[model samples]
Target: MPRRDRPRRAAFAHLGPLDTPIPISTGTAALTLETDGSVLLDVNGVPSSHLHPDPEHLVFEYMRWMLLVIDRHLAELPGPDASGAASSPPAPAPHLAHLGGGGCSLPRAIAARHPRSRQIVVEIDELLAHQVREWFDLPRSPQLRLRVEDALGALTSWREKRFDVLVRDVFSGAVTPPELTTAETAAHADRVLRDGGIYLANCAAPPGSGLMADEVATLSTVFPHVGVIAEPAHLSGKRRGNCILLASRRPLPEGIDRDLRSDAVSVRLARRPQVEALARAGRVLHSR
Candidate 1:
């Protein structure tokens, strides 16, 4: 297949030709493309997504960890190598749903690497969604989908076991919405995913804050396996940043550490035991 025909991002700025301001409900977001072809979607003053067509160009540490989990899982399926040597039969294209649209960076990366994937992304801020769609030249329906709806509502409407992966990246200001972090929300994710499917979340908390623990416990209530990935600095209470959380109905993939070692940014994996220790120190949250 021709490279242009695939939903790959270009090495040049095709979306805005330059930076543009997009008004959102809270305020305005800036969508800018750098000379190097990286597109940045900023809400308030914080970058929500730094996307390039290439998966290796991820600028966010948490995003890299998220993609690492995804790539490792996909690698398990049978497939031919780039050299076209006969390998294991390829696994079926996995279905994925995103709770927060942001700059649509992860979805774009997934599309480029796993062209057979079907993705649906829900973004509450319609203006941001529109700007991202137009500026990024996002692929049209079937291949990629955008829904202007609340994350919880969208998940509630989804069919049971319809998706192989569910990603929760929604945020209000700098913090995750409390409503979305509750045990109830985790149950909703559990309902929509197939048994053994993966649920990934981008959670931000201050150093030594108990919010991460609460979230880990909430997810544990619904999934048998849970873990977290982040930079060692973030995990050690030396810095503040997003921690990539993972939950599944079955055992998680092995060699996750090995897989993440190749990321542009260093990452640390906190498996079920470590995450549970955190959860034990905090209270489980429920829907308000």
Candidate 2:
């Protein structure tokens, strides 16, 4: 494989000749190459995906923790090859269905690390999906596939509980679409996952806000276990940031904490007390 062909993002003010916005129907998007050869997919002036030339490397905070949770169940897979050849993971590859297509960064990372994993990314914007697939060179079916449709529609239509993980990372200009927030939508997502499966959503909001908390409450209606992973500042309502809202039917103590290391800031699960307070924020508003 000839490395990256995209043009690098030059100095701050000066973009390289190849840097151009991808023309989508509703919004603008662009892919800029970083100095280190990583790629960033920008949409509507928001940083959507940060992808490295090497798919194994996960660069974002939320992404690392999301992968940590998924990596909990599976056996340790081999590392990438020095010669850049491929090495498939052992049997029982994870089956994941991502609700958003963005740059398809997470799916790419999983495919490289767990080559046999089956993944389907559902993106509403057809043009965006086409551009991302072409620019990123994503994997094909049986390994990965693209579902070009609204996340909620796809979730409701999925007849079988086949996926091991259902990731709700969809966003329309910084906010997750309203359709994905309803309890009915959550129920549909729950039905799409197999037994002991996990649901992960990226909630970006300000401190003291109930966005993340609302997610906890919504998922709680369907999932037996719901918790959050975020920085201490966000957990304590001291700052604004993104938090990983994790919900699962299985018990949280069932080896789900295997990758919850102390050294990493976002790896720590928010204490029950903190989660209670956050949940209250959303619950009170919902009751009213």
Candidate 3:
């Protein structure tokens, strides 16, 4: 990991002269001011991260669901107290990774919640990263490191079993990069996670599009426990929105299937059988 721990340098690979128009996917970010004083991150008009002044206020529902998954597994530092029994000491901060760096709202939220957790975010757009740094209050290096590199490249470059939680949020324009949805990426992610670690993907696809199911199939190649969390409408394939996919070698948190679904959350948890049925018509992606 020393190779990636080095000093951060300028890495604007897509910028050019005024006459040259860069592709929107990797171009400079456009910060839009919302009416309510919040900020919107627009990358190629995809309506990326929405920044709330309060880190705890994640505007996007999918992002909140992602944090919920992380909190269930990685955020709990020490064992809970026992009635009339000894209490476990506080544990070290968790290690987390974010494959895509939008406005880095999630990292900021994690920094606020788990102050000591070490995090690394890989952003392919250096100019956008710099802009986000100047606009928002992202955690400084060592605590939350930002690397200007491709998501897959950065993940593979790191040493094996280095993170407690890995979150995949990268996308090209709107659709996820095909490479990021393949079994190869999942295999490397499995290697990057320590024992009992978990993986989450922010899947953006229309209901009945089959992208989510295919991605689930891809992940099934690596991890045994896999599930999907989304609104009832989306889970039923009657709506379109972001669906959070969870995968891990270890089983999902105890009673998680029943724990997270409530009127307050309004999200459904579809276990392997349901997920397989959803993806039964889809195929897993593999290296050429």
Clashes of each: 1, 0, 0
| Selected candidate, larger TM-score, 1 vs 2 | 1
- The positional error of residue 247 in candidate 3, measured at the CA in angstroms, is 0.5
Task: Report every candidate's CA lDDT.
Answer: 0.80, 0.75, 0.78
In order of appearance, the predictions have TM-scores of 0.87, 0.82, 0.83
Give lDDT tens digits, candidate 2, residues 46-75: 999888777766678788778777776444
Task: Give the lowest summed-lDDT range of ten residues in model 3.
Answer: 12-21
Give every collision pair in model 2: none
lDDT: which candidate is best?
1
In angstroms, the error of model 3 at 201 is 0.5
What does candidate 1's lDDT look like per residue over 213-270, in tens digits? 7788888888888888878787766888889889988788888888878777778787
Q: Name the best candidate (by TM-score).
A: 1
Order of quality (TM-score): 1, 3, 2
